[model samples]
Target: MSSSLVVQDLGFAWPDGDRVFDSLSFTVGPGRTGLVGLNGSGKSTLLRLIAGVLRPASGTVHTAGSLGYLRQDLTLDTQMPVDELLGIADTRRALQAIERGETDVAHFTAVGDDWDVDERARAVLDRLGLTHVDLDRRIGQVSGGEAILLGLAAQLVRRPEVLLLDEPTNNLDRAARTRLYEAVAAWPGVLLVVSHDRALLELVDQIAELRDGEIRFFGGGFSDYEAAVEAEQETAERLVRVAEADVRRQRRELIDARTKLDRRVRYGQKMNDTKREPKIVMGNRKRAAQVSAGKHKTMHQEKLEQARERLVEAEEAVREDDTIRVDLPATEVPAGRTVLTVHARLAHVGHQVDLLVRGPERIGLVGANGAGKSTLLRTVTGELAPAEGSVDAAVPLRYLPQRLDLLDDRLTIVENVARVAPDATPNQIRSRLARFLFRGTRADQVAGTLSGGERFRATLAALLLAEPAPQLLLLDEPTNNLDLTSVRQLSQALEAYRGALVVASHDEPFLESIGITRRVTLPT
Candidate 1:
């Protein structure tokens, strides 16, 4: 009656000879556990391994009960009915057939003991805020958020003892997020969610962080986990300081010891030259002094080396949370300066909106799922034409679309940036790219090879470093698919950007982090 998931000495690598995890082991018990890490840290890979979607290069994964996994990207066939997607289509059909008086044993067999399957399905859908959706409705009629919820509902109705969800809230709006949170809060089985959503992470019983090809577990929720990590970092830094001091002290002692040995050798040489003692005695005394000096030098050198080793070990304990650093004075906007003007009628969605952005305004575009936030952004960026009205930018502008498809996959990161900033030399491009944390060979990496977070950084780099320097930036759901660290990095990069920003995102915390000055809500 009990269920658990365990991994033993798991090893996996990509076909490109890049190793992700090596001899990594972890366990998930009953209760919600949040898996967090930077992009490319193999969090998703581990989840897929546990779900049996991927096989490890080495080791075993054992599960005590049935397992269910809800992937982040739910690519449901739009033409499929909701009932079929939920895995109850056959049972529902059999019940209907039995009601028609067929008396077929096969129908009864398919119905099984759960005669109220229809009611259960409806109830589950209602709980997930899909009450308006009927079983016969095709997925194409529903929104992205509805699809994700249906996916979760599919797994929940099965009542599996082990459940896995990967970024389940990526496309969900605030209301859908609340429902998902409640489901996670009440999950009785082992729930491992890989997410960057801070609010969702706060609901977890514990946090499992995958970093540097290893898994580290922390008790309690995200806040508790953060506090523990900070405390540990403080301790690690203290140890590093102590070790550094020891190294310095050992070096000083070694130098002093050498000086003393040299002085003693000089005195012994003087005595030998003066012939202060008999020849045989002098010779024996000289030999003893030389041996003593050698031993002293050896001991001091050994201590110094030991101290250096300790320092290295101590330094290794410290974690590196590198943030981006940039200088963008050209992006600065003065007060009362007109940055953008939006006068558009979204006839496709039956909404008309007018807005003006001035100075260094930070505007947050908020709306329900499928309410045309992305559409509005595309219109503002001139990628789409509204039925009536126009968008005008008074300064240089750049738009970062939701898909991050702004870069050419065949080009290197440096070349991508150079394409946008044609006048800038490769060295200048590399120099600016380093501020985005793409330095050395990383700057030379092809855009296709970068991870989700790295690609976001590269795309942002290309836009911000473009020729003429954008004074107005448009980003559509920039936080989607980004890890928490990448989210922070984006925030940090935008902090340095003095341009007018209009970002469409459902992430409240991230929006607040960048200091939004205005809010634009699309009508539902």
Candidate 2:
């Protein structure tokens, strides 16, 4: 049977009654489709609903064939073996039992036909660049990137007709990402992936964007989708300009019409006061003039109203590009100042390095998965002590880890920022938070309640807005799960920072955008 997935009139809402989608509908046939949207746009939710992990409040999801789903956050037992994760442990056990001459009917039933699950699982793993992973090895022994690949391998091993992947490349390094991209490119089944990885999206057959409770399909890859959106925005902006001009013209015409009506009224009053005609004739002329003036005023008013409405409609068509706008002058360092110095052997990679950061230099840390980039950042933050060597910072330092655990979940965004900037008043903290896009009531939202992008913004705001001000900042895979817009926002925020920066990320585009002065690579 051919693979097909369809959704009709889907409606969903959170338990708190916040609606995400209402009467939403879309379809996915055979081929790879990239799902793109801003954070909290219901992409993940829609995937979960289609995967049957979450039930929709209304509407139906239909699948024509078997399905496999890989969630963004994998919850697995650390002690579970690789075979168990691959969902072949039972079959493997049954095969072993049959080999031992334990010809039980139950064992045969468990083994089923085509008893080569082990080899198939191994092949899938190897294809995903996990050739070193042993069937007996535990999940905790592998790196985060390896674990993500393993999750994908598990789905591939199942040979499902339809596969749903949500942010599958979040923790993958460049090499791992390349392998995943190749796999995605080769997928023959119906595949729907929710991701912010540009390279991965580039491999898709089409792009499906979820926005404002609707799905928009764009042909070809990410570049095509981007060009299409750009053209649309350009047209929308042009229409806005046209609408504004129309509104202005209408307003001027309305004013002129009122002025003419006023003049006519004054002239008629003067003529009546002068007794230029008989009383009956003057009365008829006054009523006729009043009626004509009212009609003229009403016609201009309607035109002005129509123009204003068109202006509103045109403005709404333009997308909002809310960005971080702030100045962190406190983070500035003198050209000759040493912001950070480190001489040590990285804990995980055992590489010796002597590094120095001066002034407002930006450094990009580039390496494959398990190459100790994260370890180096942690060591710099003093969270993890180096096995051998000294590290020093001449000014206040801050670190934004990949986990983004800096914020206190129970506190509001305002309170979280205030925690780091204790000297700042509530109003002062809120004012700064607004620049992070958490304005007014949004600033009062609890950190735990924020979406992924919101939480990242709040955490970044807290770190940058700290009382002492960070002169040296360390970031580990900062753009891992950020949507494209959020990534831009992050770059915008960093552009205003005058501090020395050390960022470890696999996203080369992001690194370039943030103005990296140099790059340091750690060997695996």
Candidate 3:
């Protein structure tokens, strides 16, 4: 059967009167579509509305055939058996009861048309690269990446015609991500996904961008969408230039008209003073000249105003996603300079990690979700003592942890930076903060009310702008929830910082974007 999803005249608002979307309409046909947007552009909210997880204030969602949805934050029961996670525990139990000589009608009813359910579950799990995970095992025994795969298997077992996935690659490792990507490529049904992972988005058939409470669809993958946007922006900028030129021409014309009116006024006054004609004739000529002058002045003024309005409209059509700019001389590291060393035995990473970081080298820590990456970072930062061995840093160090809990929520953005850099005056701090896109009153707003991207920027500003600038920076899963543009912005900011960087992440494209020079792999 043909499958599709449609949204019509959708409107939603928060209880605090913050309008998220209004009069939005879009459609998803039987193909893979990737949704892209900025942090607060309501991508996730739109998915929720279609998945029936959230109620809309107005309008409706229509879907043909059965539907399935996988949200970013899946609530898993650790104690539940693997069979339960695959959504086949009841059918398996009925088969067991029948094998034990039970002749109850309820057993037959439970096993109706699904006598082969157990075999199908095993096959699906194997296909999703979970061959080692047995149906009898508990969910707690497997790693996080395996758990996410199991979630996908559960949705596939139902064979729904329409599927919605939100950030499905958030915690998957590289190898596991490849398995999920393969599954997405083979899905022969309507699929819609929201993700920042470039590799995953590359597999989609089309791209849907949600911005300013509207949906715009582009043909092909991420690269195609980027090309289309660049072309559109170039056209918009050209229009702005044309409108600016028109405004200048109108201003010049208005000035020339004013000058001509002044000269005519003097000539009329001179004719009256010299009595060049009869008194009535001179009076009539003077009144006519004044009326004509008023009309000409009004026409030129109106034309200038209209030209300026067109310029404003043309400029508004262009988008400006500002980037950060900072110069930290103290953060630079000389070539061949020793930076840090780690010789520790982590709890999950069995092998003892002994390595040296020098100069401005970038290191990427790659591993599965439960492979002790965060633990190693904490150990390196002295937040958690290593189970064994030693770690040392020769330069100033700062760690941007996975949770980004470094800032004080009650304090304003400027105050938060000030707390970290006590020597810098408020004016100096504000001036530096503006480079991170926290200018004017935005810097004075309390940190508790910031959106995800804003909070990330504020945290980054506090870390980079602190006194005694850090020469070695550590980041954990920095691109987990950031939009693609924000990820690019982060890469740009890091490009300006001449310091050693150690990042722990599952995003391969982002890791490549930051120029990783070395790799550290942990055992699964």
Best by TM-score: 3
Per-residue accuracy of model 3 over 27-125 as CA lDDT, tens digit each: 899889999999999988888989999999999899998989998888899999999887889989999999999999999999999999978998889
Task: List candidate 3 stretches off by more than 4 Å.
Answer: 101-106, 347-350
Clashing pairs in 3: none
Candidate 1 clashes between residue pairs 3 or more apart in a chain or in different chains: none
| Candidate 3 deviation (Cα RMSD) | 1.9
| Candidate 2 pairs with clashing backbones | none
| Candidate lDDT values, in order | 0.91, 0.91, 0.90
Question: What local lDDT does model 1 show for residue 141?
Answer: 94
Error of 1 at 130 (Å): 0.8
TM for candidate 2 is: 0.90
Compose the digit string of candidate 1's lDDT tens values, residues 122-163: 999999999999999999999888899999999988989999
The positional error of residue 374 in candidate 1, measured at the CA in angstroms, is: 1.6
lDDT of 1 at 513: 93
Candidate 1: misplaced stretches above 4 Å? 422-431, 439-442
RMSD of each: 2.0, 2.9, 1.9
Query: Whose lDDT is higher: candidate 2's or candidate 3's?
Result: 2
lDDT of the structure predicted as candidate 2? 0.91
lDDT of the structure predicted as candidate 3: 0.90
